[model samples]
Target: MTTPAPTALQRPDGSPLRILVVDDEQMLTDLLSMALKMEGWEVRSAASGFEALSLAREFEPDAMVLDIMMPDLDGMSVLQRLRQSGDDVPVLFLTAKDSVGDRVAGLTAGGDDYVTKPFSLEEVVARLRGLMRRAGTATAGGADPVLRVGDLTLNEDSHEIERGGTSIELTATEFELLRYLMRNQRRVVSKAQILDRVWNYDFGGRSSVVELYISYLRKKIDAGREPLIHTVRGVGYMIKAPQ
Candidate 1:
């Protein structure tokens, strides 16, 4: 999964990144609010779907963390309403269900990503950061948002990656994975860290996906060339400039 910005990202106008958190539970809302604020982001939490909708229109957040099950309109319904009105803000769904079908439904309902309930605050932050990365925002100083390691280059604005002057096509997931690896560059990031930053989940029933994507990246990035992506057996993975 491509990781989001290594540095804090902000609005084009040089304002703090605006985030909206929508959930029914007051304590959870507060906790999420605090976590988001600690990121130096401007946050507004809504306790109900109605309040969420209201804040969404008025606040115009860059991204949102929305609970699937709410007391009034429900998260899905709220999302539908927003889509109908052309509010295309990126959303990270909060769900209590771990079923594959349910998670698929959330994505099908237009969620950018999801985290099952009983989630860690860090997961939410990482997911939202990734969403905004793809959603398009400005860096604080607006430096060119391109990453390079060896002859490989990944362009954030264009969603493009190139190697040795050749353009390479990548699926959304693959791009995310590569982006994350490139951001950390030479550091040996473990599977647990990759799972949190890339997949938006903690370690458990999932892990093989990390290896899976690493191979995918190797095929596209390191194949037939001086290897840049490597596996440190018994540890995790790292991508580096050809030595």
Candidate 2:
């Protein structure tokens, strides 16, 4: 049986929530990227406090996921700088420091929420969604529980993907693109449109970004598997269940 979808909220103006993820560890950065993208949030990653500041100015994320431990500058320092610069964007601190003093310090330093390391992806998404709701950035109510097309199933809350009862592992970008297509299933989506919706303003002026990512997605979601994402001649792409 198909999973029940979330109650319909107002459409998100066809825009993905811009999110900045900062972590010194490459693996954690990549995992956070994957998890947030699965929830249809546009994500950018940074490894240092300076880079995080630069991204806050450039990307102007609606929210930030900051790791408290890093060389040269800690998450609190970064948040301090952002607040000093008058960037009051909501911040959620993710770190190994879970002490009461640490949480108090983070909140005092302008963090909206403090999450310890080894957090469940679901919890992170839930917190981010709550932050978005409180900030009045996203639709104020719940979102669709599951986004699907054909046999492919995306559990928005659980961040699980299944095809014909077989689970699939998709990278962050892949998950975001698939979710976008599934959300607009049956409608032709152009590369330009995809770039605008998926990659945010940093399309990097590269038109082929979408194509490259699409190729990557096809390898995992379609190669040696049934085709769900399709290319439309001289047009763009579309996702439809096989006829």
Candidate 3:
């Protein structure tokens, strides 16, 4: 049975929310970016506090995900500067520090919410949604929960797939991989990017797993039909409608 589509938060003007993600870790940023984009939000990332501050001014994001510790500058100082500049964009801090004192210091320094290290993408998305809602900058995004490319369609709420008027079955992992590709239709996504976006990094991050799944998806999605998925040699893969 299909479940209800979870409402995605959006700007009051019915535009997708813009989010800024700041972290020194590239893997974390990639993962977070993928998840945020899937929710229909525009996402930008920075690798340091300085770069984050720069982007925040120009992007004027609806909300921010900030990492607390960095080599260049700390999250506290970044928030402090933003507050002093009269930009009250809600901030959610990511910290490896789990101490009460550290968290209190972050909150006291103008952070609106926070999650500790090794946090779930769901929690971060949820917290950002809450922040935007409370700030009156966001509301329910839209009614559609379907992603389509060519004749293929995937109902996010139903977890169902169909192509060329036929039903197709996918494992959980296959579903995620396909969803990522469809979301990025016509755009090449490297194996590393797919690994970060679709599978757990803890799975040893094997590119072969990506290869194996691509084959699985190929048999299910492309066999006996015009191929929507294509491989860019020495690069990655992309999905797009056939000419």
Candidate 4:
């Protein structure tokens, strides 16, 4: 119900991002609310699908995060209802199941992307940013910013990623990390930089989470393809089309 501070421009760390979180777990929702607030985003939460629908109209968030399984009204149904009402707000689905079929199903149901359970708060933040970016909601006027590397293209507005003529499906976190790398293409970015920018953190700087996420990204964005995200030895990461 509270609106964010009006600003002529968005702040990097303090930009007021309005987000709605739909999940049945009270504990998880509380944790998410706290984390989002810490990042300067205005957050509203609903514990069920019906509640989400009610809050959606009232809050009218810039983006929404939905949990797949719920009592009474499920996440998919809630999304369908929203779309039926002509609301195009970007949606990021969350689920415990990480199967390929489940991922594809969520996308097919009109979700922008899906994040599996057991995810870190950092990953969730990155995913939400990616979803907002893809929805053309990152910048004022709802215009998407283009990120490119040679022929590779990432449309933050359309949630579309393409290389040559092929399209790729990237998780929320992958999309943000890829966008950041592409923004600084051909330059080596240390893990510290990546963590700070993409994950918005500055503590315990020795976790392997970044590496694990990079591997996940490689499978989806690189793997059998010309590697775009490259390891920079004992430093961090870099994204450049193989030359």
**Top candidate when judged by TM-score against the true structure:** 1
The TM-score obtained by model 2 is: 0.55
- Writing each residue's lDDT as its tens digit, candidate 1 over 57-101 gives 999999989998988889999999999999999999997987767
Model 2: per-residue lDDT, tens digit, 59-176?
A: 9998899999999788989999999999989998998865667777887777887778787876677677756755766773455667777778887556699888888898877877
What would the per-residue lDDT of candidate 4 be over residues 129-240, giving only the tens digit for each residue? 7666556566533334556776678875576998776898888888878877776787888887777566644336564878888888888777677777888799778877
Superposition error at 179 for model 4 (Å): 3.2
- In candidate 1, stretches whose alpha carbon ends up further than 4 angstroms from where it belongs are 1-5, 137-140, 148-152, 160-173, 186-213, 232-236, 241-243
Candidate 3 segments whose C-alpha is farther than 4 A from its true place: 1-4, 142-243
Q: How close to the true structure is residue 231 of candidate 1, measured as C-alpha lDDT?
A: 91
lDDT of 3 by residue, 1-243 (tens): 122335777787888899999999999999999999999999999999999999999999999999999999989999999999999999999989866577678878889876888889987886787578668888765567678888999876578899988999999899989987886788899997787556423235468989999999999999999999999999999999877
Better of 1 and 2 by TM-score: 1
lDDT of each: 0.84, 0.78, 0.86, 0.77
By the TM-score metric, which is better: model 2 or model 3?
3
Give candidate 4 misplaced runs (Cα > 4 Å): 1-15, 140-243
Could you tell me the C-alpha RMSD of candidate 2 in Å?
14.9
As a TM-score, model 4 comes out at: 0.59
